[model samples]
Target chain A: MGTTGGPGGRRVGRPRVSQRPDSGLTPRAELLTAAADLFTTRGYAATTTRTIAERAGMRQASMYHYVSGKEELLAELLESTVTPSLTYARGLLADDVTPAEGRLWELCRTDVELLCGGPHNLGGLYLLPEVRAERFAGFHAVRAELKDTYRQLLAATDAGGALAKSELDLRTDLLFGLIEGVILVHRSDPERPVSAFAEATADAALRIAGI
Target chain B: MGTTGGPGGRRVGRPRVSQRPDSGLTPRAELLTAAADLFTTRGYAATTTRTIAERAGMRQASMYHYVSGKEELLAELLESTVTPSLTYARGLLADDVTPAEGRLWELCRTDVELLCGGPHNLGGLYLLPEVRAERFAGFHAVRAELKDTYRQLLAATDAGGALAKSELDLRTDLLFGLIEGVILVHRSDPERPVSAFAEATADAALRIAGI
Candidate 1:
């Protein structure tokens, strides 16, 4: 989504399709879709905004109307993917009633679904070296928060256990790895159904955590 | 190491340091090391042969003596990392005396060691989108073989189990993911000892595989 007026508001970028109801997809959405395709395939650094515009069926100058630049396009794409997951994770962690194990499972399941459910392998974009730039700091911060949420859930689940803090943290890292690992698998074999991976990854996450 | 003339001969690239004596590192090793540093940090596409030569403290024309081009440098880097692991895996899988479970543990432990033992996060190179190109097919083939080794070991361990083939394959994928997951963790916190990650990943791999 394009940034609205505010200090911490979203950054300036093409408006999301949902922002405009009547039209099927705003030029911004088209640009984003094209950018994501190029970024995931040709890579962020290799794919120029001009190529992105061409792929989006727009003139290079007109493409600027939708996006400030390619970096903003990447930031928006990453934010769109990670922000929803962060929200879901925060929501899951907030519910104290559910056992920590169940909460962790739900988080893993939802994350796997998100990673594999998309038309494009959006999660693969995280592998890009450019994503580590200072411009994407906001995305990284949210990602860290999401990771912390996993650690907290894991620690809570291991409460009263003999597992040391260090060991618990390692397990938490492994759990995240297990969940994200599905993206690599999906990349290698996209023909497989997403639901199968989601279900299997959820089960594997619990097993890795020794739940 | 430079490829010898054979069916699977080494491709055109810098000669490894170990291949030479007296001199600490040959110009080829220097170029490859410099290229690896740049590729892992600055990225493959963004890095040029001139920059690689500069980083290696050599003239651009001299740099060509060691490597055919930037792509060859990347090929060598990937081959150096994956080939050794594949060799080790094949050896481990061929040992019929060891139970499949023990073999799997050994495989996981060794893989983790290789992944974390390096000065650079060599595994990080795999994250490059360029690795998917046809030129890097050999690397991908070796990688797939490595994965198959894991799958075979996993299946042997699960012999006669009620677990479906699909479930078994999924577990195999998760096991590989757990071991490779250490690279990402290592990337985030480089200060941590590699041995700790190696041990924890091996253990988590076993746990994920229900060993």
Candidate 2:
């Protein structure tokens, strides 16, 4: 058994630890990568520990040396994808005290560039069902916090007359809604660039604000 | 071996023609309802014919009496949801040659109502990985046709001076972007009424069009 880290940048449940000759890379890193691919393609429930172990060319028992179970594997996959992007997003916001519109544009760009870069498994996790129901509890809090950041931008725009006077709640939701919606479309059809969606949404937001 | 009608309202697959004496429901109906529940909750891949059969209280072998396989089940789910609504939408367009703005609103309302209502299992299908990859081959065609209808409406509005003069292609995509964005949001958050989304999107579309 190999002990592995869960997705939250921490150890989750207890798993048996097996000392393997370091393949020069951390066992945890290898396990996380294999888990991410299998989970992304076959989904969390459909992809068992055995399947992941086989994919990684390890015995079933040895697979647990790194991670406890499927849930932790899922947690690790989600956490790796979400936590870094979120940390970067916070930094982007902190570095910018520009007008709300500019800040919002930067936020949209950050998400698109982060999520849509390469043919990675991260995008699938964003749309996965079981992950959303179970492993996504932590991610949702991060998402809500990000939404608040967007709301602040919208509020600032309204105050500065960058947008037409509109209810803050509606504007916030609308902006959030468009961004999420665009991400979904881009995920579904990778050919569709996120930059296009960002521009269209930003234009709409600016129009609403009368900016 | 009991037979079952295949999914997608196909004329035949493995037809279990006999109605159960006490249940008064066809095995096909039972399977579909159970499949929908399971598909939405556990997700498509996590769901199995055996599980669906057991949920329907039929033998695993007997489950094949109703549908060919899971893929067909997905097709059936889509048929029940998208086909009728699209048909109704065509009818609405045929019946009323309203201005573009009005007709677009009708399209939005109709789309929401249809999605939220009958064959709601189709929504879950959209979230399925396999379905997302293959099943949506026809989706763009549906979207293109529906978009054409809206473009016609926009042309009428422009002629009437109710909307600003704009190129049809960009205007159509923008309109689509808003509506598509709203529908995606509604699907994610079932608590929000489709009507509310329709209103918000319609307002946004009108504003963007300068109607």
Candidate 3:
């Protein structure tokens, strides 16, 4: 959906597959929805283009009109898990007036909420070895940039002061790990309220930062 | 392999494929090695019995002598990841002398080290949807027991004072998550010395417990 390079884009509408009911989503959105469900519930490597197309209520050939293949669907799905947090993080990084510690807490809360609130545990896909392929370098790069913002905000915190660079880096590893790792917890107990879970995660993030 | 129950056990040796050199492993060990390699590198669902058998230098049908099939391999590998830590945790629970906070720290350090120091990021496989099948219930129960030990140790810590049960559970989730999540960090930089990484993880665990 980005203006530049990436394996995905918005494709026009198409006729439905007779066996499946329509979800009333745009062709591209519908494809992504189908991909998210299949990728998260069925193993990604085991899921085929034909199955995703069938799930989306479209013909296999028509699905190609919307997606290049499974890899593009994966690339886009992985990006979806991180892009919102990355965008908000970029904004927070530029805002000098807000206290860095509070901003860090807010970012952690929002990030965890988004990761946990999703109908699918899309963040779980981060563990896939297939994600290491060149096609996903874009998603990894974006995720790295978001991590850098966390490091910056943590460094600006009172507790972050006086720590050596190595220590800072280590804490950043734990902080970022905890943020993304909440998906496992959320998945185990899907009934947990997202707001309280987010707040708890933010509290733990601050503590991990040695607050 | 345990004396009681599980899908795995030691099997006798056998001749191997001509093309691949001997790994100097027992036939059962060799099969597991091949499985671990294939499951971690190529996606688990993508790897087949034929491929795993060939990689281990045995005929596909002969491979059945050491194992039932792929799901057994998956169950054993998942159990391997947690069993060591779980065993250690049970011992720690019985030890009344060591301070609870220190025991918690040591457990965190050891757990992270075991997870991150592996040749392959076996923890990565925990994300696979297939893991949730009823076949893996034993592995899940063991992991849950290990987590209960973490909860007990954490509740006994001085910093854990006066906390409600819900808050304690949230912190336990964060702590366990960081321990398993370190695999992501270690995977990105495989060269990081395990000792330093483990120590840093222990430090972060204590802080996350509000120390």
Candidate 4:
């Protein structure tokens, strides 16, 4: 659904899909919102297009006019959740923090914040079985790009001598696993906010990073 | 098909479903093995009774003669995976470790080994829809009991002054999340061995626990 805005035969930049629509004030919002709620609650396979249409107060056939299918609907949900967070992380890398350790801490906090600060649609994405198959294989590249963002942050830290070179990959995997684990725990109990988990995890991560 | 051999609802063990004269060893084994494979690969909803019977070189009605239904077959598969792991975990906990930290590390390591050691049927159980609705509902107490095992380890650590008092809950949640996350990473890459991931995770976890 994305279009490249570059010149003819140019392969420089991949276009980003406008998350919802040109105008955010449309019935498309209602349908996307309904799909997200059902997919997260009932799981993707268990959730049906007919049910989403009913939830959005529209006919089943009419819902497809707004979006392509359930897979596109899931893709849109993922994009709305992950793309902005990645953008925020990229922006944080250029901040005025002088030392790499400070930058690393900032990156870690922003990541935990992105995970803990919002509705956690990524949590549902990780939990979905239907979306895991090759039917949504396109999303894997997007996910890998997001993961590489973290890897780059680690490399930047190591380049600045803030993190040890002996254990970069191990550290990165642990941090990713830690963030995922915290998300699941928070999802289990909505009463416990992500901020508390973020602060504790960030503290532990900084200690492990020797920052 | 489990039976309670003792009074007060106490149980002896899993009942032998294939011991009857109406059943034969080869057919029952083939049916179960085929169901497990299908459930693991195609997922529960997509793997119909007819499909499983076809895979077993039999008819759906003959399959019913061996078992009650697909749901029961799934329950059997799940039980076969979960019960032995619980027993193994209990055995590991019975080992002599002086401090609570040592005991907890051993427990976490053993948990990782069990999940990564072989083909995980629990993956299908977690990813399956109906199992979450029907079978898992009955096993909630078992999960709670497993959580208590971790709770005891955490409390022991707290008693021994191995971890900070305020961070106990956060640590426990993170630990469990690490194990679940490692198994998930293993499932995503069948070509790669899980041992490397397990060792890396285990080392990072030891660091996090300040071991």
Candidate 5:
């Protein structure tokens, strides 16, 4: 088995440090999936780049093609949980045809599903102190923008319009709290389907909107 | 530099290692306060018993008289957050006079206030993987009991009674998730009065009830 192109058996770009069977499809994606698994399972600061690379089935040095260090991996993983939601939220904000209530409902449901959908509870990683560092400010800022989107969507609702200006921030905070808090519940009761959780939360979020 | 007693100060225990000047008062409580501060701020697994004792202004040896180890401190701190609520919930369950909805609102309001009332975000410690260990099962059990009370209260409500049997758990989960999720919001914006925060959440919880 030489480095050029070995026999068929889950070999990607460069040879792995010592392959231990993983869901070997795309090498880069596989590395990220492995990083997500380790960061959530083992404490973030405790996880080493060497260990992550080995788990991803690549030699530590060879893994640098995709990531500079654990920071890069951690940052990317954090972003994955929020970026899609933000994009969809922005689109929902811009879509003038849909009712604000409907848009907010979809946003809540999808956000819950996405937060719970990962094989690992990646949202749990938000608790790590390292996640508060400047390196993760990008993730934080994106999250803030997403929350603002929630605020705007809530404000646009007929019910939201009925409330005082000061009421919007408090309402958004409560609604967002419920949506994000689903991670902790799912972490303990993972048997529930993501779709079901999302629907139920969206339904509940409406109560907050009008309450 | 004497060991017996200090002249005119809040020192109520034996000598200290290094006087760092915490809110000098009851030694055991001061130790716990310091532990809560470090566990939430620096993180649980990272903080050491030695550091906790040092912050509380006691020798490591003296600190042992109150707590055997960090696990003991952690268990106590975790329990502190839930036991009072559990006690009140139990009383509310038996009261027979109060409406289920009102009782539920009071519980949510008080729980939020207590969670944010602490100098540190102790609920944030719930994120530590160590918290899920068997050693903290007592805390988990009490928390489960509290949630069960929420379920019972919800089921008793006219709104909750209208819901199908299957819907109760999902509703209880959403309401609870919002209640617990307030800790994360309060952590970032600790300036808001806990009383105001509680009132706002309890108000929002009613929406979930009817929604």
Candidate 6:
């Protein structure tokens, strides 16, 4: 995973002997984790690559071996956090067996779990002002796709005439909005357990969808 | 009000003679509006007093006559945006005639209107990374008081045992989460009307509260 023989490439630092194989984290994974923590707490703009390297227990030069730069690190963290849910949402949308309401519930539950159950509160990155820049356009595009999936599922559930065609778009927005609200609340009060909030948010998501 | 006899004070710029009395906005109010627009769109960190002054049609020196600095501009915007809602929530809490469920719905509707009906989307300020800083501690505190009001109302409506005591707090979080979700959606797609979204949200809030 090391970058070598590239422009501006230099020899990265040596790996630490203290790292154990059983620790269940690759050097790259450790860097991402460290980056997520700093990015969420101190914000993406305030955090430096050196700080991330120190947090991950690697030398500054060695950090480049695993990741290209700080922006890439943030892009990676956001993709890792959001892409899995998008993939799962796509899979559910393709599935023919489950009803739309059930699929929506599963999507809400899985999303809440991913957001609330993560070791670091990475979902808070969505609230960062820097993330809205053109450089992070890919992240916003994927996020919009995820929201589109919600719109699809919501339209499916509206087949019973529960919601008018005009209302589907707004309901979709409200549904995801309720689910993502947990991130903001969790940010404000980190000590509180997210399990209860996650459960209640999932329930609220379903209710918002009229399921 | 114009500032006079203050340190570094000077007649900063010529007043626009085109200004009319019926415009119904003071220079300070215009500054606040301009700041909210820039802060919400360009972000607090990226926005400067000069830019805010330019947007509000005043000189940078004159801008100081209205606000102490960018942080104070933000504090003012946040206080203006949130304090009125806090005051209204307090009034509702003090009122004995309205049932808790009705009060919650009213709160949801009023909040949505404030969030969505504004020309400049002031609620987006809540998403800025700068607002999380210690300087804006008062904003977060008052926001908590608003949330607490929701808790009180939710508890009052729990008379029939629809929700257990433990669920009230989480529900309050979800309740506000759902309402505030409108801000995020409005930020994404500003063209859509919020009235329908507000109506659906209020209904969903009541449902989440088990009313």
Q: Top model by DockQ, which number?
A: 3
**Per-prediction DockQ:** 0.47, 0.29, 0.67, 0.27, 0.54, 0.39
Across residues A1-211, which tens digit of lDDT does each residue of candidate 1 receive? 2333323322223333123323356789978888888877777779888777755555678888878999999998888777888899999888989998888888888888887888777777775667778999988898788888888888788541456878878777788877776777777778888776777788778887888
RMSD of each: 8.8, 8.8, 7.6, 11.7, 5.6, 7.0
- Number of backbone-clashing residue pairs for each candidate, in the order shown: 1, 21, 0, 0, 0, 0
Q: Give the distance in Å from residue A35's predicted Cα in candidate 6 to where it truly belongs.
A: 3.8
DockQ of 2: 0.29
TM-score of 4: 0.76
iRMSD per model? 1.6, 3.2, 1.0, 3.2, 1.4, 2.3
Top TM-score model: 3
Q: After superposition, how far is residue B79 of candidate 3 from its true place, in Å?
A: 0.5
For model 3, the stretches where C-alpha displacement exceeds 4 angstroms are A1-16, A19-21, B1-21
lDDT of 6 by residue, A1-211 (tens): 3322223422323243223223468988888877887776666666779877866666778888889988888877777767888999999999989888888888888888787778777776665556677878888888899988988887887542467667777677788888776677766667776666666677788776667
Best by lDDT: 3
Please say which candidate is ahead in lDDT: 2 or 3: 3
**Candidate 4 chain B: minimum summed lDDT over ten consecutive residues — where?**
B9-18
TM-scores of all predicted structures: 0.85, 0.72, 0.90, 0.76, 0.87, 0.78
Predicted complex 4: CAPRI docking category: acceptable
> What's the C-alpha lDDT at position A35 in model 2?
78
- Weakest ten-residue segment in model 2 chain A by summed lDDT: A10-19
Supply candidate 1's per-residue lDDT for B135: 94
Measured on C-alpha atoms, candidate 4 has an lDDT of 0.60
Q: Candidate 1 clashing pairs?
A: B3-B10
Q: How does chain A of candidate 5 score by TM-score against the true chain A?
A: 0.88
lDDT (Cα, tens digit) per residue for candidate 2, span B1-67: 2244433332322233233323556778878877877787677788878777766656678878778
Q: Which parts of model 2 are misplaced by more than 4 Å?
A: A1-27, A57-59, A88-96, A132-135, A159-167, A193-197, A205-211, B1-26, B92-96, B117-121, B132-184, B205-211
